[model samples]
Target chain A: MRVNGAEVEAAVDPRTSLLDLLRETLGLSGTKKGCDQGACGACTVLADGERILSCLALAVQYAGREITTVEGLAGPDGPHPLQRAFIDHDGFQCGYCTPGHLCSAVGMAAEAARGVPSYVTADLTADRVVLDRDEIRERMSGNLCRCGAHNGIVAAIAATYAAGPGERA
Target chain B: MNPFGYARAADAADAVRLGSAPRAAYLGGGTNLVDLMRRNVVAPATLVDVTGLSSAIEERPDGGLLIGAAARNTAVAEHRAVRARYPLLARAILAGGSAQIRNMATVAGNILQRTRCPYFYDVAGSRCNRRHPGQGCDAIDGHNRDHAILGGSPACVATHPSDMCVALAAADAVVHLRGARGARVLPLTELHRLPGDHPEIETELEAGELITAVELPPLPPGAASGYRKVRDRAGYAFALVSVAAVLRVERGVITAVRLALGGVAPKPWRARTAEQALLGAPADPATFRAAARTELAAAVPLRHNAFKIELAERTVTAVLADLAGEAR
Candidate 1:
């Protein structure tokens, strides 16, 4: 499987979760394991550019798939746009959940771009999704911010993609 | 979590062959199974990965839908046909776990998910009949606000946790299964068994049976359908009481009504009695309330869950009233 932009290989026990393989084996500690169970989205990562919980994900199930973590959400220029937006919007206090928030936000942005209808998305037949504050909160509900920095997080996300072009279904 | 052997099956045939391991279980997106594994609720020695099978969502020429069991929950909810024709299904699927779990969970896996009852998950502290047969059920006299009020037994009262199953029950969805006995189909309503003396045997599937697909019936004209879930939190929380319904009214009369409930029963409680009471009745709140009360007459609630009986009636009446208004 590819991690970030590089091809990576590791021999892992079948019990190894993608979170364990990343934090314990591959040395990518940016993805925090807040809850080994699936309740907390602190271990969120992008599999094939879609958000998924790494703690519940079997490392073997994701073999040969591309995984992107917070560590890889940058260009040669520096921190990714969302990362910078998080800073500008003060999207963190203790910063424990920021990494998961970053990756989840990126995946959520793409989902909105794809016009994926959320539970709160009123019009199921609508061609475009409006990424308003309601949309951001509902889409990112999986990732919990314990520090109560969700207001800032929502601000950052809104500033980034709420007004951006959404996808037509 | 115990160490387990893993093998991916290319198709349903291969899946059955691989599932022959004595303690083997089919693995989809590990949203629920993994958590259960970590909690020691189930410790399978072998896991047969079945995601390699068909994940197609086919909009049949008959205006119905056939969803492959391996299709992701997100995929099923976001499909154009599902959103347009079967909005109840789409809404129910979306009402479930957050986007990440939906992206990881499969159609069949959602049907087979275990209850999220705290006592059931507390392997070390609580005695669950499903977890350990003959060991008493603590939920009967324990903090059982989250337990079942309908179709419960002295042995168990755990509610089925999938919001999507409630919609399928109301929609008359058919589940296609392949097993050692060849192939068969079961109505989505009949797929799950009540926790009557054998909560361990949750589903009607024989050993090594694989759910291949789920077939949805076409919606009737003049139908207004939706799923309404009441939960503790606004998001990411399991339903406290959910109502999935489809209503077709003509001249202020209830021509057709399908209703099912969640978070109140061992299985998706299809309110067939309520539908029978509702048919040909006025599409007014008075008739709706009466029908809901009639359906819930058999509700036997636990100590902490007695409120659910009244809540269920109110939810049903409200949902029907909302749909009746929409159908107008």
Candidate 2:
């Protein structure tokens, strides 16, 4: 499997979660593990461009997939647009949940762009799903911010999304 | 987590063969199984990964849907066909876990997911009858605010935790299974069993059975369906009480209705009495309330969850009223 644009391989225990393999064996400690259980979004990562909890996923099950962690969000220029947006909007208090929040917001932005509906989506027949404050909050509910920095997080995501994809770099 | 041998199955048949091994369990999304393993609630020596078997969501020849067992919760909830035809199912799926958990959870795993009873998950608690038969149920006298109110035996008071199964029961879906013996189909309502005297045996699946697909029948032409879930919080929490309702009305008269309640029973509580009371009757709040009363008459709530009786009644009435209003 590829990790952060690099092809990596290792013999891991079948019972080992993807979060464990990434943090322990691959030395990609950018992805924090708040709760080894799936309740917390601290272990959020992207597999095949979709957001999934790495703690519940077995490393062996994701053999041939492209695994992207928080470290993979940066480009040759600097931090990703969402990361920069977080800094500009002050989206973190304790900064423990920033990695998961950044990755989750990236996936949430992609989902919104694809017109995917959240639980609060009223009109299922609509071709475009509007990403208002309620939509962003509901979509990001999985990622918990114990420090209660949700307002700035939502603002950063909304701002980054409004800036279009090409303006990110 | 205890060390376990892992084997990936090639197909459904191979999955059944592998699953028949002693102390072997099927691995779906690992959302619940891995959590349980970490808590030492269950320790299977072997794991059979069945995610590669089938994951398609195809339309059946009879205008129904055949949802593969391996389909992810997020994929099923966002499926265009599911949203159009089975909105109740889509809403129920979305009402469950957060976005990340939904993306990883599978339909089959959701169907077979265990209860969220805190006592059942407590490794140190020795009073869970579901974990150890003939022992005792601590929730019966302990902190049981989230326990069941209906269809609970003295031995156990836990509730099934899947929002999707409640919708499936109201939709009259069929669960397709493949076992070492042969293929068979069971109605969604019959898939789960009441605690009765044995809370240990939750489902009717045999030793080596693997859920293949769930088939949903076509809805009536003018029928309207929806699901309503009331929980402790706005996000990522189990339901205190949930209702799934499907109704068809003509000229203000109820032609057909199907009702199911969750978080109130060990299995999805099919409100047959309520459905019977509403058929051929006027579609009004009075009638809906009466039906709810008739169905909730059988409730035997414990110490802490007695309020669920009133909550279930109001939920049922509201869901029916919404469906009836839409049908009109």
* Chain A vs native chain A, TM-score per candidate: 0.96, 0.95
Taking all chains together, the TM-score of candidate 2 against the true structure is: 0.98
Give me candidate 2's interface root-mean-square deviation. 1.0
Q: Candidate 2 chain A: minimum summed lDDT over ten consecutive residues — where? A: A160-169
Count residue pairs with overlapping backbones in model 1: 0
Tens digits of per-residue lDDT for model 2 on B1-328?
8999999999999999999999999999899999999899999999999999788999999989999999999888888888888888888888888888888889999999999999898978557889888888999999888989889999999999999999999999999999989999999899999999999999999998999999999887789999989999788889999998899999999998899999988998888999999999999999999999999999888889999999999999999999998999
Q: What's model 1's overall lDDT?
A: 0.92
Q: In candidate 1, residue B16 scores what lDDT?
A: 92
Q: Give me the runs in candidate 2 sitting further than 4 Å from their true place.
A: A162-169
Lowest summed lDDT across 10 adjacent residues in model 2 chain B is found at: B123-132
* lDDT (tens digit, per residue) of candidate 1 on B152-192: 99999999999999999999999999997798999999999
Which sections of candidate 1 miss by over 4 Å?
A165-169
lDDT string for model 2 (A12-122, tens) is: 988899999999999999999998888779999999888999998999999989999999999988889888889999999999899999888888777777666777888
Cα error, candidate 2, residue B100 (Å): 0.8
DockQ of each candidate relative to the true complex: 0.86, 0.76
- All models, RMSD in angstroms: 1.5, 1.4
